[model samples]
Target: MAQAGGRIRIGISGWTYAPWRGVFYPKGLRRKDELSYAARQVTSIEINGTFYGQQKPQNFAAWGAAVPEDFVFSVKAPRFLTHIRRLREVETPLANFLAGGLLSLGPKLGPILWQLPPSFRFDAEGMARFLDLLPQDTEEAARLARRHDDRLKGRAVLETDACRPLRHAIEIRHESFRDIRFVDMLRARGVALVCADTVSWPRLMDATADFMYCRLHGSEELYASGYNDAALDDWARRCRAWASGREPGDAERVGPRGARVPRDVYVYFDNDLKVRAPADARSLMGRLKLLAADGTPRR
Candidate 1:
């Protein structure tokens, strides 16, 4: 569907405490009114805490009622699915754990993030068996781990029918998934790569799918301290470009210093330092609105 005002959809991570403009907004302002305020301006959010455990169905229902229908929520699947199982032998406990909370997320749920632990590096045999074990309920995610081994031989596995459009994005923290060949492996399998922008790990910012997923930890400036107004404003400009496809006339020559131009980007701030995530997100959303007024770049 077409986006609002030809602008890209924008969202922050989970609602966390930030002074004035943290990830979602300031903690002091996180009352029902504040959440509603932020929700009106942004498009979606990644529910991060779900990784720890499932929430009660009442909680999910309340959340669903809170956000607008257009709003989408991407939830991190609990550790049981990604970290604990790691495609090893399936256990009833694991299945029960996933089913417990995921089923409660209801329809507003967008994607179930299967973020593998950093220690669990690429392993074909282990990953293949893991892939086979993933529950049919959760949809879409990349198997970046298994692509590394030439010893592995098989077509890219796809279970679109089982989960329908539910898909996964491979989060390649290590350099191993950096290779285009590896990314191509995911693309062929229909796994959208998770585009993460951090001072440490920057994935290739390419259009891997029509629906983009991004988690922006921080730039070199705020990488350590979390995001500030300036940092968020910069990102908002890029988001405008991604959503609308409009870029500055001198974009090619502008380099990094020019007046902010939209880059094809979707981001969620992870820099939770000093409760800055929400405040930064609010600031970022304001700048993006300004950019949208100027021009929107869409793909």
Candidate 2:
């Protein structure tokens, strides 16, 4: 919440995991209270469920109300649009997705993530066209929602409380996306290039938009590993640099330096197999002074 740097939100990728049941969620805690409990520990959460299928308006409303007012949720775009459609002829699908009640999250919604398939390579024209289809604000999203297909005829939400900016971030897996031109395209489109930490994929840190989105999916063993003290420390430092509106000096960037101005940042830990995500998230939050030493929020 410091003015020197824009809002920096640290959290786990998702909240529902059986392994996390007594580890992240307290023992004997009711299933419904899991989200509330997790929200108290971290400032934000990445809802990965949306990537699988369309959710009802009430589902989003309940989720938004379950968390604190200061908490936010970054949703994963449905795979029907990103995987099956592969950024081709997605206007209706995109509209259907937006119509599926994302606006129901209201002020609690953050960025929408589009994670490309690993085998999917980069195509400048296709990406540009896809980016052009993204709604820039909630009003545009509501308008787009009005065009939803019959699949959501009964469940569509086509209204908004007020106009607000909508942000998008893309996570690329193929090596072809390592090109600087791709970075430039994202920068031009005002979409954040997800800085994904993986063992094989191209891990880029090029700051393209007014905000940064990062996914820590384990450096050694993919989703099965945990970030040690040293790894967490390095990530915290890089996050601080990003929050200050400057790329880390050691960032493996594909493009040149971007504009220097305070920027908001979102970092989510996806290594949840062993229940290390929540712990790692809290550690990073503590390092950034968002959480006190005793696992309580600082401000």
Candidate 3:
């Protein structure tokens, strides 16, 4: 069996279904059922909207109850944390989101992704100041790089201290994040890079992190129209290969963090680019499972 941290644990960004972009997987499935089905097929999910704002505590609690044990959720911290507040406010929404039974997801809660906007460029002085505002690790950096960073070292600590403390994963949309120095800086500080696959430009394809984090935006030119089965299947295969310890034939060596081991990959489908995230996730999951069954090369 493919384990959470071991295999290509696939998932979608949001739970809502979009039929506009040819996504109809959730037509028959109820909301809870949709979540349950996704849990059976995929191992993880990256909650997208949590960063935009907070959700009802009861809703989060209900979500925790819908999925199976061992399923993980890679949630995005609210925009209040990364965009608007910039790690300033730590009382109302953030606190509520973390302490309101989110742990019910259990080991299912992977990392809370803090996706910075394009304006949030990588400035060593600024980032260093920001990092200094966060927490620190108990052991040395080397020993801790391979593991999770303690939330008490910087702004991350402030967030964690408030109750919604979870693993921190970051995705930078701006081109500035492509720089080697910037990427390594993130790894050095124990921040995971998000490998965003968009039609425009692919950022940090060869970057290293404790785990793999991917978002399949769209195909070559139809980025806004959504993804076809073919594109999804292709992504699924790549994810499997990464997880199975089989690098792509043309795979280039990216920078290494701590050890040189390949980072774990997590794939997410965006809601805007695609009509139905859950359906697309299911189709992608089916293809991955089929590939697993055939023991075929993930290409």
How should the candidates be ordered by lDDT, best one leading?
A: 2, 3, 1
> What lDDT tens digits, residue by residue, belong to model 3 across residues 1-299?
36333456667776555443224444556555766665655567676667666554456556767777656788777787678865544334444445433444544567767777767766766665555433332122222222323332221211121233334567777766566776666667666667666655445555445566777665554334466877776677667656655544434334642444444667777644445455566577677663345532132
- Candidate 1 lDDT over 102-163, as tens digits, reads 43445556655667666666665555554455443444222221232332223222222234
Q: Is candidate 2 or candidate 3 better by TM-score?
A: 2
Worst 10 residues of 2 by lDDT: 1-10
Model 3, C-alpha of 170: deviation from truth (Å): 1.3
Counted clashes in each candidate structure: 32, 0, 21
Between the candidate structures 1 and 3, which one is better when assessed by TM-score? 3
TM-score of each: 0.65, 0.97, 0.70
Runs in model 3 deviating more than 4 A are: 1-5, 18-33, 87-97, 129-166, 200-202, 221-223, 226-234, 244-258, 271-276, 290-299
Candidate 2 regions exceeding 4 Å error are none
RMSD of each: 9.4, 1.1, 7.3
Q: Please name the candidate that would achieve the greatest TM-score relative to the true structure.
A: 2
lDDT of each: 0.52, 0.90, 0.57
